[model samples]
Target: MTIRRALISVSDKTGIVEFSRQLAEQGVQIISTGGTFSLLEKEGVPVTGISDVTGFPEILDGRVKTLHPAVHSGLLAVRDDEEHQKAMKELGLDYIDLVVVNLYPFAQTIAKPDVTYEDAIENIDIGGPTMLRSAAKNHAFVTVVVDAADYGAVLDEIKAQGDTTLETRKRLAAKVFRHTGSYDALISDYLSKQVGEPLPERYTVTYEKVQDLRYGENPHQKAAFYRKPLAASGNITTAEQLHGKELSYNNINDANAALAVLKEFDEPAVVAVKHMNPCGVGIGTNIHEAYQKAYAADPTSIFGGIVAANRTIDAATAALLSEIFLEIIIAPDFAPEALEILTRKKNIRLLKLGEFTSAAERKPEWLVTSVDGGMLVQESDVHTISADDLKVVTNRKPTDEELKQLLFGWKVVKHVKSNAILLAKDDMTIGVGAGQMNRVGAARIAIEQAGEKSQGSVLASDAFFPMGDTLELAAKAGITAVIQPGGSVRDEESIAVANANNIAMVFTGVRHFKH
Candidate 1:
């Protein structure tokens, strides 16, 4: 197929000038509308105004320019079809071999700090998508290009074969639909959110690729990282890497787990996570003390884990952190000498996440997961509990110190896997038992891990106890206090056992089941 004519209209003029110059050099007639026409003509390229071919001036501020039949007939008419060719000739319409178009910057426009509704509505492209769809639907004869990266390949194919091959045309057509689909989805998402529709009947979202990871959870799997177009500031994706190589799949998962735990504390904190679970969490008045307490919580499990700090990493804390072979260290900021000491290890990833701001500044977003044949979407688990929310269901009430520890343990247990048990003292986790078959098994694991430390420590369960066996097990471990969401049929049995052992048990009425 010989190239005869082309149409060019773009919002992002990344490579339109050079690509159009190549097409014009190949004796292809170029037709452009509005700003694109002025740009091409100013750049010394041979181009005709879109109105010249359509014999109609642009109306309604260029919104009604390319919607005319003069342009559609040229793009949709089949050269080999007898009736189509006859209709084109009788109407003095010519064939359009190629279409190069990109939509208006509605996403960028809405992303501004203070954009008006009228501005966003006006930026929605009408002619651009219509032109691309017309050309794409007739891909058997017409070629369409939406992405600038494809310009070189399309130009190369044209130069080599005098036209793009059928396969290349099909690929470009598929690319056009994906571009237009995402464009519409973004507009839909923005409008629905503005109108306070949390979950629309037809929901869609868009994300941009950040980078390809080394591998997924295992080396045998493939993975890449994608960021939402409007991700919250200072999130994992927004963190600036100060040293080390790109993050792996496990690294991101573990770091995310560390951040979730770190967000629960406003004081200086350190959280160590491994295998998508927090191995240890500590809170202190300063970063150095927090590091010491967290390491003391579980030194063996902290090895090769992701560590996140809610305070600036000082020289002393960095010195202690550098002694271990940690996979990643993320903090709000780092001192000059601290970076110098940590950077000595070449394989560790160091990230700075600006400041330790509260999650109240966060915008609403869906937590999505992919199942076999469908997807699941829900809001994030940001529910918080305090001493006031606790109901002293047992006859023996907790002391001041035990109540404080129970509140601290409540925050950490919510992030753990289902059938979870967390043992804590002085805001540091001494033992965390997660993902077990039953509540008793999880409690036994936590109690065993705490050992002598379990004597005065408190236990937090993610859900209600199905029976009183867990309380009996805790009683044997010398657990002083307990916190759980109590609604089980055997609640009185558990309360009786707690009273018998003088254990302070409180019902939070909040169930946190993390599967």
Candidate 2:
């Protein structure tokens, strides 16, 4: 499949003129369309207009330009087939050996802050995708280029062998399909959003690769990070890495978990996460105070965990943070003095995120997780707890101070794994037990971690206790009050236990199962 003729049409004209000149220098005739033809003619590239080959001018505002049989027949023709060659010769159709095309900026068009529906629809490139798909399908004879970065490779191949190798053609064709596939998916997603369909009969989504990682969760596995182009702001994908080493697989996972809990508080707060569970969390008037309390809650767990703050990290806090062997530190901003102190440590990752800034409005987001052979998509756990949402179900009602601590514990517990228990006092988490096999087991772990601090701490449960055993454990641990989603069949028994132990209990009527 020696190169003789090539079709060149591109919305992005990057290197198109030079690429056309190089192809013409190789004695290949260049056929172009629309603005591409005008620019090549003006640049003295010796190009043929698409109308000259099709014998028909572009119509319907250029939407119907390249859909004719002349274009498709040229691309789809089998050079080795007798019947196809006979039909092509009889029909006066010529083969298009190479296709250089890029689609209209549909994604960029819709990204405008004030774009109209009509404007978006007009930007969809029908002819571009059609020609690329056709040329890519007949890749044994026709070479296709959808990315500007591939222009050099294609030219090198042509310069060396007068045609692209079959392997290169296959690689380029696979790339074309992926490009067009993501193109179509973006259009489908945009249109579905316009129609307000969360789950249409058909589904399409795409992610742009950010970088390849050293390894996945374990050393033997390969891994890469990808970002959803349209993901909501304030996520780990959108954070700016200001300092330190590249984030590991566990670092990203733990940092994201910490941020999810950090977003639950508007006050100055810090959340320390280990292995996707909150080990410690605190809220206070300032970041230093919050960090101090969070570190005090579980110094052992916070030693190597990821820390995320809802407020700018001040110098005093940064000094304390620098003392720990943390994997990562994330916040809305870092004071210059704080950065000076923390940057001295070489291995810790520092992420600056504007998403947690006060000016950015918190919006509802969809949570997606991959399963064995399918996927799970649901609304994020943005549901929050407040004083009004609490319904006291025990004979003892929580005092004002006790209610505050219970709510704070409730917020932190939601981010922990299922069968979770968190103990809180003075707006800081004293102990967190997560991912236990049983509620009593989780309670026992949390109680042991809290030590003497567990005596006055209020307890927060991610879900209701199936029996009164967990509450009895909490009571013996000296937990004064408890908050949980009370809908279990044995809820009355749990309430009876709370009453017998003179412990205050509240039912939130909502469950937060992180798993």
lDDT of 2 by residue, 104-179 (tens): 9998898888999999999999999999999999999999999989999999999999999999999999999999
Q: Over 4 Å off in model 1, which ranges?
A: 355-357, 360-364
lDDT of 1 by residue, 36-123 (tens): 9999999999999999999999998888999989999998887799999999989888999999999999988998889999999999
lDDT of 1: 0.90
* Candidate 2 structure lDDT: 0.91
Q: TM-score for candidate 1, please give it.
A: 0.93
Candidate 1 at residue 495, lDDT?
95
Pairs in steric clash, model 2: none
How close is every model to the real structure, measured as TM-score?
A: 0.93, 0.95
